[model samples]
Target: MYGAVLADGMGLGKTFQTIASLYSLLTKGINGQPTCRKPLILCPTSLVQNWGKELKLWLGERVVPVVVDDTRADHVKKSFQEFRAFGHGGKPKVLVMSYPCFRMHKAEVYRMGLDVVMCDEAHFLKNGEAQITQAVAGLASAKRRLLMSGTPIQNDLSEFHAVFDLACPGLLGDLKAFNKTYEGPIQRGRDADATEKQVTLGLERMEQLMKLCNKFMLRRTSTVLKALLPAKVEQVMVLEALLKGIKASEPTDKVVLVSNYTEALDVLGGMCASHGWPALRLDGSCSVKQRQALVDTFNSPEHPSFVLLLSSKAGGVGLNIIGANRLVLFDPDWNPANDLQAMARVWREGQRKRVWIYRLLIAGSIEEKVLQRQLAKQGLSKALVDDVGQQVRTFSRDELRSLFRVDPTTPCDTHQAIKCSCSGSLQDLDSCKERAAAAAAAAAEGAGSGAEQQGVLGWAHLARALDSPDPTWQAVSDFVRNNFVTYIFSDHVIGETQHCL
Candidate 1:
């Protein structure tokens, strides 16, 4: 028998619905006998503890929670080895694990013959080739399976196929046939007539597939779940003066106010080396273990308060940093969805108090234009591919002129109160003024002709300097490159000889 999937939006209680469903299953006496087969709840590691907490609150003493933290190969193997032994004997009713650990112990998970497999935030398996997706696909033999996600299609239709494939394999047929019939024509940006034909056929097929797998999947939205909760307060905190630190400066208090990810990674790497942890590159290329360790350290209270560098591509979703109450977005990303998800990590339920989110925008740069487009797009209730195309056509010329007019010398007098915007109290006005002045100075420096002379360098340059062939060049190169971006901000271009080298 297949179960339903409750894919409610963020801040809507999908967690609560999951717990209720599990409780209903647990209460039913199977064949007049108490069933001991526990459900397997697979989720991101950051949410493992959250799920455990929720389960304890709902079912209290009726369920057992086992969290798998496999730091090494042996640790992972040993955990699964025990799961197989205990699971076969009709042990606990629920086992929770992170997606990473689930993949490592997939063979054991299948061998244990779980009754129900429930995946939360299931969008992690959107990429068909990812290890976790393959592992999930292999678990189709379970008695019941449930897949859950809020925004199932963040980008395109192909992502939906991966989730559906896991829930009901043959229903969608195969990827090739599915794509040729539906996605192939639609993704081409076909004419209105062709697009309508494709959508009509696609929805018909989708309806049939839903009917076939009606017992397996269910999707719910926020509007349907609103009645279940009480009135809530939403607080918005805006820090408009923060500068995106693409340019570097000396270690001043203002510099610390908004450190770019590159600088944060450098500092974190040094700290890791000093603490005997393997030095980590906080780029997208880092291994899973490296990232987990960095996250553990950052969340630890004993560790010095420091910035964590995260690439939006890798760290935008699934990762949670519990200790961070304040967020300074160094630069805006291309996708509004990615940025919103990244910010949601700090604003989620477990947060103890009001969280402050700061978005740094370079007043007259391409960054500002990007924000403008995001705001404009958010206002539209319907899709506007044609309008977007027309805007893109005129974007370059209009954006260039706007970018040149970002004057930092002009006073930014806008002010809204923290908790109550209508309070009219001006206690924080002085602090806001100082920040505005600093932002203006930074923007003015960025707008100057000198900024163009300060050529940008890649991560490779720093990597080479750190491991230079010549010992003499090591110190010199490191010092020069370390101060390169900062020096450029000062209207002096140093290490021009190393430009080609």
Candidate 2:
């Protein structure tokens, strides 16, 4: 059994890549080994239909996959009945199913074994104690397992351990051993008040973890898609900054609103109705069959829909809504990957218009704290996947305490912390102009390495908006369309990450 990971950033085509991998194996047998004809694809319920669509679109008459949407025991058992008794012959078949559906029929799957067992958005198995994770841990020890996730580690290193351990069981040892060895030392180094020695040790262990994991993981940033797509501008604005319909100003502009909670979606839907904006929606209440219809209607120019109301959990993955060049993530997700997935819905390869993605946060609220946490997680991901700078965030005892207390002192705690001096009186605003020029020069000269390089990857674009949401906001919004945004991915700064597909 072998385990590997395809940790490409969102919209970089992990789905199509997986499909290609499957196509290659079925069409060309690996030298001495027999080709894999029976493979299982486990994904979220919402993606069950899309997976089959992708496979069929690519493979066409060469192969047909059985997608198990009906999860009743008899139906699931019947899907695998051939596996129980027949030999591998005739048409090469594939099985695509949701995670919950696989849980119910794991016994049948386990007994039948498999050639390839791949999990999409494998981070769903991040929780070690979750029943789904536990079930997947067993029964695939002999098969080749491939885990695909844009975010392998979300909150902490333990989540990485769980998913990695599943894909390549025992590669990182058991949870307790992994925590003591890698998790503890790495986290301790990120503390704000940590001694120099602690920082050095954290860097060492992080590199070691990276070295071992890189053997099987193939990770790529969204930069790969830069050649195929048009420009994308992503901004992180306090809700107060949404003074006007800035990004989606045109009556013909297509927009999408994604919320972490469905109730919030309801409020947005009602707001659309109040404005008499035509909209289509996909959520838990919507059936699987209706998902494509909703997407088609939203994507079609003739439909005349103004926006698509999407609940992140349901429509986030395996969805392409390029018809809408503008998207607003109404709220932040504790796990940055969720927000990243939702944001990638539009700024992908097929988009014709320049893209704009907005991440709205209430200043000084716990919501802003969530954005800060996202930066830290991005650091961990960057460290593990690429030889990139360390971005994992560590909070001081006082900083952690502030989570409960709202700071009325600052309009933007993030800008204040970095000591950017971008916001204040009109005089400070002028200084911000000078500092912005210097920062742009520094970035052109390659900026500082590691952590320092992150703050400057793309700064000239954000200078004005840090002060006010006047035309200043418009400047930054327009600037983002052509630049790679690191301000949002910085461990110290606050903003949206690169969300290109």
Candidate 3:
């Protein structure tokens, strides 16, 4: 049995490559047996149907797409068991299921005796403790395993361990040893020289492990698939602004601001609508149905709309909206991965024209800080394209002072400032000290208090809440007896309390 993962960059057709690999393996017999045993492709719920569609297009009539949803659990299990009983018989049987469904039916899946399991967007199991990871691990004991992800390791190298652990257990010793060697150092950023040394050694160990698993694994990138993709272009639009309030009051009045969506819509809507582009408004407030409908409209040629207003939270994952040459990120997300994924939405296959990515930045506020953090995370030098990827620049005291400029009128004592300079390192040290002090204070306060802490309501409480009888009517009667507050007043009180909380 062998397992492999294709960790390509986003917009690089990972799905297509996985499909191609499966197709080639199935078409050619392995060890005198057809290399298909009802391969299971596990993915996110939003992408389940999309996977089914892709399978139909790639495998044609040779494969059957089993869509597993919550309502048809028994039906799905019976069908899967039937397929397993029948066996592939020299053909492939592909079962498409979401991560949640896989968790709900891992036993059935294991009992059905699947020959191969392919996890799409495999990063969902990055957290080793997650239920999905455990379920996938249970399935990994099967004959073959395949992991597919664009970002196989994000934020920390240990994420790679989680994927490999599922695909090929015992390759990495365990989470503890792996973290001490790889994850701990990677996350320590620029300060961990000892950690970096460990990382260097760990990479070598990883390479050796890869060789041990060589018969089962393969990795590729989008650059390798360049022949299959169109040219792409990214554009950055910078907006400059200064503090609108008086200098004296600016420090106190500074607000945590985000782009006004209503105002943003007027601007983006005009640009996209002018080009006869259909607009897809995707935000946290919109329901799943609304988001999907917008995606459908955006993908339709009859609509031909280019403008898509996407919320970072909702559009960050499992969305495959494509074919718009232009992309406008109305606001910046704190996480670079989130922004990258959003940008990749337009850069996927079938996009013939150059993809133009427009990042709208509000000049001087936290937006600039957000952009700088994003660049730093990418191992780039600065926030702008010119300064990126050169050399890592350490901030001096004066430079740090300039970056986080305080209004001259704001109270500042030169004597007090002498205690700690404004260098980045000094600021970090001060932050650590402050956190320690706060923790000490909290500990002291908690120790002094004799209050008994109550645990959260459990499942029994939830069941009782659901089954309680006459409680609603009794509560209403008690409320009237206590104080004949008008229905409007009671409603207002409840609404106000909910809003305040």
Q: What is the C-alpha RMSD of each candidate to the true structure, in Å?
A: 15.4, 5.6, 19.9
Question: Which is the leading candidate under lDDT?
Answer: 2
| Cα-based lDDT for every prediction | 0.48, 0.70, 0.52
Q: Arrange candidates, best TM-score first.
A: 2, 3, 1
Report the C-alpha lDDT of model 3 over 351-425, residue by residue, as the tens digit: 665344545543344554555455444432111111111123232234334545433332222211223232222
Ten contiguous residues with the weakest lDDT in model 1: 381-390
Ranking 1 against 2 by lDDT, winner: 2
Return the top candidate by TM-score: 2
Cα misplacement distance, residue 453 of candidate 2 (Å): 7.1
Encode model 2's per-residue lDDT on 1-501: one tens digit a residue: 388888988788888888888777766757744467678899988888888888888887676677887777787777676444454446677888899998887876777667778899899999989988987776653367788988787778899988888888888988899988888988888778877898888888888887888888898766667677765555665322232344334556688888978899888888778777777888999977688768977999888887788999889876889999878889989887888889888977678876767777666778777776666666566666654344434445567566656875545565554445343344543443454455445435543123222432223224334433223245345444223222231111222232211
Clash total of candidate 2: 5
Alpha-carbon runs more than 4 Å astray in model 3: 25-29, 69-91, 184-231, 238-278, 282-296, 380-501
As for candidate 1, its clashing pairs are: 38-93
Estimate the lDDT of model 2. Answer: 0.70
Model 1 lDDT, residue 426, Cα = 34
Candidate 2 TM-score over all chains jointly: 0.84
Clashes of 3: 5
Clashes of each: 1, 5, 5
Which residue pairs show collisions in model 3? 3-216, 4-217, 277-305, 277-306, 278-305
The global Cα lDDT (0 to 1) of model 1 is 0.48
C-alpha RMSD of candidate 3: 19.9
